[model samples]
Target: MARTTTPLTNTQVKQSKPTDKRQKLSDGGGLQLWISPNGSKSWMLDYIHPITKKRLSMSFGIYPAVSLADARKKRAEAKELIANGIDPKEHREDQSRLQELTNSHTLQTVASDWFEIKKSKVAETTSKSLWRNFDKHLFPKLGHRPIDKFNPKRSSALKLSFDIGI
Candidate 1:
């Protein structure tokens, strides 16, 4: 028969003392609070990776900051993802990748890409003039803004001079 473990309480967690070695206090369902020898506490969830079938552990957050209730909620979400045939770690990685891509695809970045393609095809003088125009007119307002939020009509230089070649 499998042994059953008792869940932890707020008082127990609060009163937990640091020992010479690191200790893990189980809150059940693969959720546990890890106490380091230095008394630093953090939350962790242990689960079998859906694809690899290997035991994996994910850190929820530092204790007190994460709180017991919040850790349980995160555990439930990870469990749900596992049940849905999704790997929680992979899902998190995918979301981070999307966020990074969104952050990188700014107006300045798009403009730089256009400059690169045009650079090889145009004369050096024209290239420098084109970049100078972008720096003088459009970049000041829209350089840092993401492409999705950029409005062409807001900049007369972009709409008339660049778009229509005026």
Candidate 2:
């Protein structure tokens, strides 16, 4: 049988059958979202992790639950995470959770995330130096430890950023 592409629109997604099976939506890099016959729509992330050297596949929740705009945003965030040597899904969930995203959080946690955020923009030497410093001075003594456990001084955050060129 000749093959053709079917755009996975909300309308089309609503009409999908559980038996519809895997259907090709796009092939030139933008081929992630696909709908099953049962009308279940999911976003598939195609990226490779630098450290693991393995391809990453991620789901952006159900279609209706996660709007198209939100899905695209997640895809972008995932790509940014990959660029920074951090797994977006795991790291965000593990460290930068929404509840902890706002102010009034640990300076150390925020600082670590800041490092991850800036990993892509800085030079390799800078990035390595920052981590090396942190690992040697803080990590072995108080690193890999939870945020609240340390009660990091609030003023310390500002000092840390300036020291690391963050």
Clashes of 2: 6
Task: Please list the residue runs of candidate 1 whose C-alpha ends up more than 4 Å from where it truly belongs after superposition.
Answer: 1-6, 119-129, 136-141, 151-166
Task: Give the TM-score (vs. native) of candidate 1.
Answer: 0.76
lDDT of 2: 0.64
What's the lDDT for all of these models?
Answer: 0.88, 0.64
Q: Residues 76-110, candidate 2, lDDT per residue (tens digit)?
A: 77777777888766876776565554434554565
lDDT (10s digit) by residue, model 1, range 126-164: 889988988988789878877877567885656775675
What is candidate 1's CA lDDT for residue 101?
A: 89
Residue 154 lDDT in candidate 2: 55
Among the numbered candidates, top lDDT falls to 1
Clash pairs detected, candidate 1? none
